[model samples]
Target: MSSPGPRRRGVSVPRPGRGWWVPAWAVLLAVVLLGPALAPGLVLSYDMVWVPDLTLRSDFLGLGSSLPRAVPSDAVVSVLDEVVAGWVLQKLVLLLPLVGGALGVVRPLRDLPLPARLVAVSLFVWNPFVAERLVMGHWPVLVGYGVLPWVLLLGRRWRVERRLPAALPVLVVAGSLSASAGVVTAVALVASVGLGSRTRAAVAVGLVAAANAPWVVSGLLHAAAGRSDPAGAAAFALSGEGSLPAPLAALSLGGIWNSEVVPHSRTGILAWVSLLVLLGLALAGGRRWWSRGRRDAATLAICWGVGLGLALLTWASPDAVAWVAAHVPGGGLLRDGSRQLALCVPLVASLAAVGTTRVLEWMEDAGAVMVAAALVVLPVLLLPDAALGVDGRLRAVDFPRDYADARAAIDEDAGPGDVLLLPLASYRQPAWNAGRKVLDPTGRYQSRDFVTSDALVVSGTVIAGEDPRVAEVARALDLPTPDERADALVRAGIGVVITDLEAPGEPPEVAGEPLLRGSRLEVSALDGARSPAPPTGWLWAMAAAWAAFVVPPVGVAAAAVVRRRRRRDTP
Candidate 1:
């Protein structure tokens, strides 16, 4: 493999010098594209579930676990709600990753001219995959997607220089915030080490494992509890409609199962265009790697190869995907293999940046700018409707006043036992949400701790977890006799039964007086069994694991800052 020589009108052209302006321009472009998300009101959608009433939990530190994914975004949302009354914080939390991802894509192109760098950033951020994920409400994975390139960059520096970067811990924490992203980051780190120093890789791995101990411990506890669900694993296996081939989806980066999120007419066009651009750039990058054998390029090639290979396997082979999901710990976390294709985004973006620079060198400055501008704007023009709100499909809307009132009422009346939310469904079509797809918002609105029977829905099937309480609750609701139902509720340690009045059914006649009756909700107190608390040892163990994950990263980051300051003062 060799770098293609730049030629223009039969004359050779020289490469441009590195400059800081390209990154600054890339940041500006990202902010402009993602600016709408920063609007004043909540942008509600399927998985982008943010409510002002949601509170932080200590279990958020548990790595390789579900709760950990919401921790980062929840922190931001909570803080914003306390300081401000609008959706500005939620929007910023969502858009921050896009900005980081844009900068990550452009940063490696420091050697390239401004036009080419901008084109690469635009293509990376504005692609169909990003748009689809945004619509699907997987912003945490997107955050991981944004931080990945920087993680690789920092990991490479550590491997080569034998000194960890100050930002390495932060990047690791960001990347590991989501389970899918954590798996990708762990794999990338090991791969980066294989390409460089084994000793440095071991040290880096140790620190990462320490930082992720909370989730790892939680995962271990989950495994010990025999809570694994094979049906859930199989349901999450990668497969696509016959219309879109798995390989093409991997290349084009658009295998979203939800048809509503994808633009029907322009999907094929965007897919093919992205496929061709990425393949061409990857070929060029591969050639450069073969010739020079640079560690960075090799690491990127490995990432692209792994991401593409896994995506293809998951998408093309159902049995293989199911097998992996069942056998591989935490594999079930990635219900959509298309999300893994995000790893390829940065690699492709980097190659595209190089390709853009190469193509520009063959033309005059003005011609290069024109070509770059067209390339940068092409994806956006093709998928014009795939912005933050999916072109108005996901507009911001306020929750009804009744929701707040119900939450307040629950806080005042509910006992230590959990509130049982009715309808026992994983999803809801709330009247207030404008018919948009959303997770059950009862979890978000209730002030008292609550439980819902909404098992994780996959492939239109409700895959039940180890908890039999949801099933028990469903049975209790069907007992026919009010006394039996009341006894069942008591046995379940349910202090209050909150029924969604908007949930398309008449309220069940229970034995107790209605505590709070509103247009949207009805709450009734249940007297029977008390919910048992976990053993004291379990709580302490979780706390210890959380401390392990948090303390070292803070210390390392502080030490790095102090060392830098002391060196500066030495002058």
Candidate 2:
């Protein structure tokens, strides 16, 4: 028998330098197309009220004020001027991963093709939660969650390129600085490195430091506040074991993709085809990994280890529990573990992309199947509660149209700091309707999103669930009527009155200057308060901030443009 000749190992064909541009362009195109649909404030369900509730205006940016009570630290607020800046910071966090993916896809990485790179970028830049974050303004979480994947990808590149010494520390520092989300991401990145032995010790150190950094910082911050709690919140892993049904648990994973807040305008027959394609890719990737041997196994293992480890930490969340016990001194500050799952989704998406690529290589003919799966099954499997909600106070719907009209009618008649004696719950309504800052707003206790629960109502009322005053108020706010309540507003020196027109009883009697009447709201005022000067210092600060975010990136784009133009002209 003749000895078998050496078998050829399958190798990925490398492309030229110019090809890298394609991935960047493709991602940019996708983002631009999806911009209008995903960029608005429509996707945010609960945080909508909170962001604006915290909105304060200072002379700094002329952007207006911020909520004094929203942040835990005066130090953080002192450095940051506007609530909008804070909101932007949060949006940046969410966008960071997409930025990283774009970098990896477009930058001069070795041994990757334009298409392969673009797919990697799309796996994250196209994430649904990212779009939601842009609206909601969970800056710390978004920032932390978004930066990790790029760190991991960079770690992988450093190993392949023999630049571990320099890249490792950079990765560690970047990972540690992002706060809680960063810590979790750093842990995941190290876990990925450990799956392969090349930079195991360095990776291990980075992971350990990443995991512990928040606890250290949070601890110090809390200690400065002069308080500590030794016990923490119960671990969700154990506590939620029975509370969540299997279906709901699955939904939690998928529900983040679609929300009750946003309209689903893209749904059509194309959906079915997308589902099939994603499914085909997953199946194909799985088969390829199993047959490819140890190197592929190790790579997949690293990805899985990092992703799964973060998931488990979030599941257990002893750190979070302990932080809560210590009253969020250093570590417990980022109370929810669910935020870490944001990073996990992208990691899983990357795996999905890898799987799709492998399937394409193996079957060569089943690309259509992958697209179908993405369109149909994935959406079905992930999101079941796609129904849009109607506006109601009880259901937590702040009617936008009614609120806007009411606010307009009232603002025309009111001045700065003049009390608008609408229903107490009217303050809880949307800003466009409320006309002035509300004395109280409706929020949840132990909230999953915003932390204004205690402040939303006057306590005990929510626990008893039977404040007759609250019930009566809710009924009255639903309709503006001439009752004893209207007489009380004039007595209380309320300058303007805004209401929803249809009240259970007669409209409230107004004593102040009558401005105008809409179908929903009434406006009047006793006096107009002096409008304060804009905070010139704050505007300069905001100008600095806008510069901070926009200038560097624009410079890079300008350089790229010049380079491309020069290249074209050279020919």
Candidate 3:
């Protein structure tokens, strides 16, 4: 094996302070990519709903009647939005990952030259995987993907130095924002930080479990609430984008099931070019990476192989995966196989960086620099549509004035029942949002328990949701006459009904004068209902789990502070 050195022949590692260019370039690329999407209003897209304020409730903590897909993510936002505007927080959530991901990908290849670092950052921050997930509005998933490199570094630090990373627990918590995020994070953590030392392995296990506790506890708490339809496993399975085949698509990191979110560029020649570049780089740098990062290479193999296998299984053998999702508790998370593909990123970014360095080594100074610069720009040319708000699918828009009016009217009464939305649909293609499809934002917009349809309809296929209360509420809406309907809704625990003016549905009438009426919404109160339920004992358990997940990282960070102080004082 080659000896470790700061300056290797033909490779040009960065001098200290000069490395600022890496993250600055990453931030610049992110700005170019996000473009208009970073404007003042909320950037609402598929599953990416942010409101002015989110009411903290048991439902937000996964004590809801349905699944905990948004669990700690919603809860986290609730806390953050208080300190920051939701619009600004949304932008930060979208921005931090791209910049952070670039830095993380560059960390492992610190010994490599500028060409290598630039290429890794470009590919990591601006690729089909990042593009598709961003357009799909899976912010937490991107957050998880961003943290994988740090997880790898932690494993290496422990393997070589036998020292636990102070930020180890923090990284896991960042990655474990959602159940799917937690699952992929766990895979990366285990693959990179295998059970070599008994003590480290034990700590790793505890960290993994603690990080995953929010979603796991939420899922278990609501386990008796319902089960997802087995059919979802097939519906959400990874598939080829446009004309590309599934396997090639997977290898190229371009297979996301929802074609709507895919950039138009992926449907054509850029796809093949990306595939070629990925394979060429891997082959070119494979040897160097193998020599330097043997353990990392093994971890990469496990992660990529397992990720690809699971991604394909969801497409080819949905029946088997569907069985697991049906029979296993908290297994529905595996239904979206495309998420696991995040596992393939660490090695790709690392190898691509070193590959550029190796390729540059063959040419003289001027030629090599130009080639490296061209490679840095090539990722942009290949996926040009990823920039400017993902081909303009992502743009900021303010909520209708009626939303605030309705909330204010409802806020005054301090009524009993949970808020109920009209139209009874799970997803909304709101006119206010330029007809972009989003999970209804009303639930998060108001300071009340807003019950919405749990079922999701994708590509004309309806995947039943877990909440049985959705059915009872739907039945209440079907009752004859305004009085009977109002009575049924109140008895069924609907405190108020807020109907969207733009949505296509006949909102049931209430006998009394409406509380608030506007161009966009009609708010009516049901007089007989009781106020929202108080916090159950389960909420304390949920809080404790979140505290457990967070406290270790706090302790570690505090200890680091103390040690630094002691060293300074002695000197």
Candidate 4:
């Protein structure tokens, strides 16, 4: 419960008059790390897709025919995109973690010297975990990851005061941008605000649970909630790039499943050396950090242990993982195992700071202060490629002009019947995006009901898609004769078809003559469509679920009103 004060005399990284430099340094680091990601154009890497105009749709709320993997993040973006430009919103989403994380991570460690706080910021923001997640375009996860340390800071205060932080709901909601983000945030909230007092814990848990309602209610109401593809468990399991052991790789915060996202230096000897140094530093700090009666330390330690343990479960026991994924509703969310590793970040950063402090104190030489100052940017030195938008892997690119033209052409003739994206793929490796894999943006760009594939092909293995309509559409399109295919598609509600030339695969033989053709896109209108009406059964449920997010604020407002009345009455 007591702060470990400074280990010895303070060493100024800049000139430690005040701690103003902490946040300023964080902003600078964010600018450097997110160089191209903040450029004029949108960042459309892998899962991070931002369209010119994102409209509110059934899909955004998880009521679409396809899987709701994007869920509330898509919904949130659509809401924000109404006022803010898509490109700017994308930058904020990208910058939230890198900048907010540095600010959050240093809050608890302010008791330490300025140098130690700088070390925490650098380690927390510039590490492999943050880099890999950024490159892979999991911005929502990064948002939650950035919020973890702040949760810790507030949790410590909550425990001491026996009253919840007023900002807890806001923080939890911010963290719950996506289902994965929601899951992690809820776990963290529970861990940080433990059941020391039943009433306080209940209040905290209820608010946090309400924050997660968007995904929780949607996932449970989903038809496939009880069943998920188990094969993905093996496909997305965490590994050490086949160079280091899984545990050490995870401990070092480097083992992401997507080998392409892992920094080039991660496989080299320097990486191993860095990992050993990090472990040594953590051990050095843990002696002082993980002592008796400190609830903050316990919360972080529990998180690290549980996070690493679950991250390893998929690797250590594949069969068990497969069973769980198959049997549990929304268990497939955990298929990408490294997501759990996010919980390890707050603890590790703190340890690194305390460890740096102890190290500086131990080294009695005058130059030791100078040496400790260098530790602030050690994360950057160790993982140099993480800067400058992951070595230009995440450069912002404008959508080709054809996309806008196609959307307009399709919109004019688009009736009740659904539009189908041709070449029938979930991802597009567009040339404009430098051949980077991005989720097809056509659906969001045009405010229409566009049906596309959700199936993912990892390596050579094809994981089955969640949308049952995709297979039916594919079957209808694959009929023996062009006439038969066209007739079949028309009767089943294929209104307009848009084909992307940049994406691999030819347009359907049944696509007939193009209504509007561009260099990269071709739109064809189909007639005599009879599309089935979208299910409206879950609308009330979803509305109620969304309403839960509002309840906490209402409660807070009511509580404040009551306190005012009590003061007035006493006087």
Candidate 5:
């Protein structure tokens, strides 16, 4: 499996000095791209508050949140096991891939000029989506996506040298672990390596499939469990789910692309301008790059084309989205469907980076320094601090003054493992920063996310207007219907009821005690019901598995360092 030498079809191969600019350019690019994210002010704190709300509920209820019970109580319990541990762990997860990527690129870094290394690292660091993941505490998804380029780099190295045993397996595992984002990451990696021979591509595909087996198996199990509906396959080809205007609804989403200044009335000139620029670049250089000149760029274009096409198809036809969505292991839980755009953002950024790099290189070659500088400045001028920086808006979880006061009051009355019934929205806010669990966590409105086979317990399907078991649970609680069932939830040993507005019909307060009260939220405690305890067996098993998974990679890397040293000495 000898690697091919660089072709001369107007492509810039990694020559000793010529490619040095790539890394430096990449970093500068990252800084610029992330400028808005690192900017001073905050935007709307929607996601931050929301995700933690799920965590808080899970902490109290022990798999009681809307998320599937099988989602591993460890996921939520991990939030409470250590003091301020969750945030620290999340930050580390985000950094791991970038660090791993740097390690993976060591050989290439040494071989390439300093400038190229700088540019490459910079490009990776400045990627807008990557920045977003780090700031938002999307540790799992970010770590998955972050390790991707390194996997591609390793795979490419293996393809060139036939080091299949090592790199191939690593790529597979990386891809599987990143199941949701990894799908796109795998697509990008494969495309990045498309510059190699066809035989290599075949092997890579096979290896990728083998590695993704875990995710595949998980999906199968979910489907078998009736969490997914196979009937949705027909939706993929069906026409008229909505108009193009429907897909464009992302325009209404605030906080993306300095929407504050741009004003996302769907008529913002800046968005239109950005689109035109992207289109013009694609039209101007897309075909030339795709032709035989730069195979990697061509492959990237195809990957982006596929992702975008799939996104649009889903938007246009629910059937299309539903078909693919249903097949995905946890796909049914995702309602936005636009979340697929999270995949597209990086692909688009990479393409834009390539385009930027090429255009600037062309300008420099033509000695148009002033024009090139202006070209760079235009992007700088157009993009704002909010679009690129760590503004408060990006912080999804922040305790509002009123919410904080209420939580303090409640904590005085309640102990650990108590349940609360309040507006899901109130719980959605990041203010309930208690390291313990709450009842009825956020994001449970989905179908497949929560379930229990026990006749006494109801699954998410039952609660989310789907499963019949929900009605049963409602009746058992002495409530006639689902809505009343929610109101009646307090009687089921809810230690607290926190809400701004009281329910219309006064069923009278619980006999327990008033925990806390603030302007908007209220916290009440229940009198009876046993307090919850830790799952000793589950915790021990999880801790053991966690240790097993973490130890070997570290040991292997250390052993490699020693082995290389010994070999060098013997030689």
Candidate 6:
């Protein structure tokens, strides 16, 4: 072969095979991304709650609950609690997905030099949308966001290579853990299946359906029982803040409705800058891809178009959105259409990476380095505390000592029966948690299975499971006569009544003698004890579906490991 042509002047040469470094970069990126959470003290606020020495339950597949979203993180928390503090586990729960997200973004861009790749990864992980969601305490959704890129990557691989990537099942399982993320992945997989072979598409569809069986089955089972919240759809409609263009802000990923979660300053300017930069870079990358005829360019372009279109439809076409939400079962689950922007994040990151690499191709190595440095540093300047703790440190809140003791006492005396929480409410702002907003902890803290009237009230309407027993208990608490209250409690099958002494309003004094007393809570036993509702047929179906989805993948992974070990030993 003739001598290679002279290297082009001022063109930065690509590094030789930096694929191995992707994982290392991902780990480092995670550490940087989670810097605020890694602070010395626990950072708890907005939906993050960890009680010291509390027992964690593994009943994630139980029917009529969305708690399955936290199952993976809860498992990690349980393990991490064995060595480090529980709060550390909570931080890791947030950090791990981010690391996964970064890795997913970086893996496809391994052809680029490390610096440009890092810039792209940072751009994806440290945007205003991510910051707002983090501050809003949507960690599970964040986890899904992190897992999404990998799902797309593996899906593409399966289609192009005509063989299942070893990681597909794992990513499917991980993505399905988050309810919203699971839906997004399913949608993406369905949409992208046309790119692959028929076999590959069928396999992808099957795995996605199986992975989502838990929530899918649960949702289908309770479809008739639950109602839609139209107001919730209206409140969480996708739109920009004051004076900002909705489409531009959405593409920039900064249209969070909650002012509390958004940065006080720089939001408007940052949105404009981000939109312009991303759009310019994407256009440049599109031109490059068009010239080269790259399939990825088309794939990413489709995703971006679809994501932006959905977001716009939700923001600009409220009637269309409302119609979809009403007609489609569980479509109300996506009441926050802003979440659909998650689909655009990876595509934008990829295009940004391509644009960075293209720009670097025109510069000398040193100039490329300088530009890359600026790209990496840009996010920090625009969103200073994006990666750090949102709002403030999350100090660990302990349950009242007496509350724990009372739970113990109730466990000893009260047989198997459901506990009723008072004053009846769907949500709670506990004094112990420094008044942080959280779902009522009665079901989590009580010794026995607990029932609360707090249905998931979406936009002032009960959109999920509603127990008339919860209503009966609420009425019982309102009764002035102790005997009438006691009768009502018995009828509702509330064997044990636990009242939050600190709750606003006077505590109910039932006729029954108090069985356990504490400073924060008091428990009294009903004379005619009632048992908890038995597990429904749908629950069994859900459990079976989860088992089928989880077990086979685990077995396949194990077999693959065993085969590798066998080959290594033979060699």
Which has the greatest TM-score?
3
Ranking of all candidate structures by their TM-score, best first: 3, 4, 1, 6, 5, 2
Which residue pairs show backbone clashes in model 3?
416-530, 416-531
Residue ranges of candidate 2 with Cα displaced over 4 Å: 1-96, 105-117, 128-136, 157-178, 192-215, 218-280, 287-335, 362-429, 433-571
lDDT of 2 at 358: 49
lDDT of 2: 0.39
Could you estimate the TM-score for every candidate?
A: 0.88, 0.47, 0.94, 0.94, 0.59, 0.85
RMSD of 3: 2.4
User: Which residue pairs clash within candidate 6?
Assistant: 42-394, 43-394, 44-394, 426-454
lDDT comparing candidate 4 with the true structure: 0.79
Looking at model 2, residue 29 earns an lDDT score of 36
313-369 in candidate 2: lDDT tens per residue? 444565555555355334443333444556455434434544544433433234434
Query: Better model by TM-score, 2 or 3?
Result: 3
- For residue 568, model 5's alpha carbon misses the true position, in angstroms, by 6.8
lDDT of 6 at 60: 37
In candidate 1, stretches whose alpha carbon ends up further than 4 angstroms from where it belongs are 1-36, 58-86, 193-196, 224-235, 239-242, 283-286, 289-293, 324-329, 364-366, 456-459, 504-509, 568-571
lDDT of 6 by residue, 1-571 (tens): 0112123357655673656555665666556655656654444455554544335443334442333334444443444577876666666667787777888777766666666677777777778777777766677678778877777777776666676777778777777665676777776665554534666667777888887776666666656533344555666667675457677778787776555567653355665666677777777565654443356556556666776777777678776666666666666666677776777887788777767767666678788778767876675566665644543433445566766676776777775456777777656667876776666665555545566654555446554433445656777878989899888877777778888887766666787768877778888887776664436776577777768568756876887788889999995
Per-residue lDDT value at 471 in model 4: 75
The full ranking of all candidates by lDDT, starting with the best, is 3, 4, 6, 1, 5, 2
Candidate 5 lDDT for residue 268: 43
Off by over 4 Å in 5: 1-44, 49-145, 164-179, 189-267, 287-302, 323-338, 341-367, 385-392, 395-418, 424-511, 515-522, 527-571
lDDT of 5 by residue, 334-394 (tens): 3223323443443344334334445544443334344444444443333333233333234
lDDT of 3 at 215: 78
Q: Give the poorly placed runs of model 3, Cα more than 4 Å off.
A: 1-17, 510-513, 531-537
Tell me which residue pairs clash in candidate 4: none
